[model samples]
Target: MTLSNTIRWLGMLAVIGGICRLLMTPLELMWGTDNTTALIIGGITGSVFIIIGTAGIYLFQAEKAGVLGFIGFLMTTLGNILVCTMVMIALFVNTALQDPQILEQDLPGPIVPIRIIMMITMNLGYILFGIATIRAKMLPRWGGALMILLVLMTFIPYTDYLFAVVWGLFYIVLGWAVWSRSKNSETKVSVTQ
Candidate 1:
């Protein structure tokens, strides 16, 4: 429907996806075996999260989002797509071929560079996006600043999941802000009309 609605829904998806990701480790532990199921769930949700989250961030005020925001969206989205594709392949191999050992093997030579690029792009892109969001002033200042800070925080040991949840919360807040603004604007227009 409206751009605000789209962003709201996408933000919800990001939240759900983040929760799914956070569950992966615990689920694997409970199952006490293969991580195939967890990987599949995480990969699917993670893909949705990254793609939609990037779009919501990029389109928040596209005209004012700036070059860094654009680059951030492209890099993060592409990197997530690549990583998700690899995860899907892993799922297929584990399920169809019943070969978990394949995953243990070192990635092929060609894939190594791609993995490195994905890591750099996904991390750097989000950082830039956060900065751009702050500069654009489309969302709350603290939300944007938190985004940048959370991304940086991921580098700390044992904080990946913690920051991920916070990141998802940021999306939720941004989505609510956009949705509320749109609703208020619509109400004002109706009254004037």
Candidate 2:
């Protein structure tokens, strides 16, 4: 398929991902992270779609996005992938198998540092992506602004749940922006023809 087509489809997927992300808050509140089903639906399966969606978001404006955009894309993708890994570990290795000690007992080296690094990269990545998105002007500017502000919000105490809600809204706006923009451009092309 053409790149444009791919991006449009991915944007649709982003809508799906956003819905799943919104569900995360309620799922966590209900199941408290122990339910594997909730974990998978809330983030595991959703993350795959989110990665694809965000890739489309970046590629949609790669030309205008430039170097900072590229770096932001990399970090954003990396952070998402890393979170997926951690979620899988939490679900299967920790929950299904019920081997809480296995992670600490069988791990190679210290994992605390790695986790901290992930956290740092994740926060920075979101901020970078937000700035890049705004500068690119391909997606919704408000969504980009929301991304940066949401990262800042993470610093507030007891605001963890807010993330799922806001991020869901962010992706929804992003996807809608992509969808509408492409459709508008296509209409213009047809009119010109």
Candidate 3:
């Protein structure tokens, strides 16, 4: 119910979602299984993070912080939600219902334009969120910085996917940082009491 509680929940969700994505990527690469299945799994796993993040965005508005940081979080949440939803659609509608060969062989119909737009928006949202992280004192500066780096790398045509991997590592580290910070803050509060 409290702001801190919400953030803690969000962090936990991010941890779970991030790990799921990380795991799914390798499975896709190694197994070459159904791409739709992978996206659906990833999307479902990521939905938790989106739910938590949505709450975090609302909570952030009530807390004191710079306008930039607020905007960054807002953009980050919006972008994540947008991308996640797109991925889900792609998975269920495109990959699940339509011929899988369309995507695999680039015989695309509706997916190409939609995916391109989603990718652009999602990447931009992530980059902005990373910048916001730098401004917000709730997390480490390095996490935000790393996100910016990931964004830049992701835009480099061929290296963007690599950035996605790096982004996953950063997500785990950020989650650990959040959990640790929450514990430490609780200890301090208890000690003071």
Candidate 4:
């Protein structure tokens, strides 16, 4: 597929991944929940999101996107990968297999630093990326602004599901924007021919 088509599909995948994250909140409440299943799903979705987010950053024409976009892409992609892997290990191996109570307790010393770093990178990176996207003017400004807002919402307590859904919506908008733009470009090309 062409680059535009690839970006469109990746954006769609990101939307789906965000939806999966929304589902995870409810699933976690189920009694005798299968952590393994959650981990597998989370890992897959997170991977998809990472790809789309990373690609989205670079897909913005480099000259216009600037240093902020590049930094955001690196941090966002790396943060997602690192956090997803750590979460899987924590939930599946550390808490599920070893001690269920571990989830209730504070993070262990080794895990604390990782969590801190992940939170900063993931949140800050997305915010920067959103700003960069808006600056680049390649996608809808509202979509990029919404991305920044959604990440900010994650910091609020008791709003996990709400933010996840909203985040998914933002991704859906982004995907639509990418897909429609590609389609429009193709139409223009065909018309010119």
Candidate 5:
């Protein structure tokens, strides 16, 4: 496949992932506990899609193989993988804990460590991915910059909702960029022909 096609695919994946995570926040907030099924599903889907997209960009050296893209891809890959791993661990923990009520508890014993691990890994992963977005032409550089901001925002205490909103905005920007770029390309090709 062409490099542009690959990038398009990757861009689509990011858009999808961003949207899913954005949507999940509300579900998580409403439930006030881990959405094990959603988390696992999103983790798997996001990882696969991102890998394909990142690989495409790397394989094609999209944009002269800028260090920014490479760094961004590295961060995104690591961060996304970490988040997925955390989700897997949470699933296992939830299953093994055998206490459905554990969800209701605020930071239960076994969950404390998991939560901490999740927080650290998750934030780091996002930071990296946000960086990757910055280096990509798939969307506006501002989207990536905003993603970086969102990543920073996550560090604030009791601001998960704020994080979610910022995160959603990032996706909205990315999605628009991807959609518009693809359309522009198609138009250019048709006109040339």
Candidate 6:
């Protein structure tokens, strides 16, 4: 298949991924950020879809995105991989903790550091990527801005469900941007052919 088709497929995946997260909003409202079944399932699956979408977005504008966007893409991709690991562990660990024998509230010692790193890298990655998107002018500035702003908005006291709503919206917007880019790319490729 041509590169344009590949990107279009990725954009579709991104939208599906965003929808997966969007559906989780109701689950989170009912479950409240715990390692419930819905979160565990959604988190891993959505992360996988988003990761592909992540690469697609960058490839969609690589030339225009430049060095900054490259770095941002790397950081965000790595951060996303880490999220899958963390989420998986959270489910198993939470299950074990529920028994009468376990008392710990968090993951083991080494994981604490890893989790911290994940947050730092992901946030910084989003910021850089967002900046690159704005500079590249290939996609909407708000998409990039949302990438940065969403993390910053977390400082406010939003509940689990509310955060899920906002987070879902962010991904949906990103998917729209990617979808748009892919369509434009297809048009260009076809016109040239």
The TM-score values for the models, in the order shown, are: 0.73, 0.84, 0.73, 0.75, 0.66, 0.85
Displacement of residue 146 (Cα, Å) in model 6 is 1.0
lDDT of each: 0.66, 0.75, 0.58, 0.64, 0.57, 0.74
Question: What order do candidates take by lDDT, descending?
Answer: 2, 6, 1, 4, 3, 5
Query: Which of the numbered candidates is closest to the native, going by highest lDDT?
Result: 2
Candidate 1 per-residue lDDT, tens place, 21-48, comes to 5566566666633477677666666566
Q: Tell me the tens digit of each residue's lDDT in model 3 across 1-193.
A: 6556656665666666666656656656764544655665555565556446434432432243355555655666666666676666556656556655444556456756756665665566667666666655666668667767776785478763454466566666676566556654531111121
List ranges where model 1 is wrong by over 4 Å. Answer: 25-29, 32-34, 96-105, 160-167, 186-193
Cα lDDT over the full model 3: 0.58
Cα lDDT tens digits for candidate 2, 1-193: 6667777777788778877877888887886644566668867877777777887777777777777877888887888777777677767876757764565564555466666666777788888889989997877899889888878887888888878888778887897777667655631111121
Model 6, span 1-193: residue lDDT tens: 8887777777777777777766677776666555466656567777788788887777777778888999999999888889778777766666776542232446567888888889988888989998998898877778788787767876767555665555556667767777876775562322121
> After TM-score superposition, what is the CA distance of residue 49 in candidate 6 from its true location, in Å?
0.8
Which ten-residue region of model 3 has the weakest summed lDDT?
Answer: 184-193
**Tens-digit lDDT string for candidate 4 (53-119):** 4564356334466788778777777778776767676666655466655756687677777877888
| Pairs clashing within candidate 3 | 154-160
Query: Could you give the C-alpha RMSD of every candidate to the true structure, in order shown?
Result: 5.2, 4.7, 5.3, 5.1, 6.3, 4.0
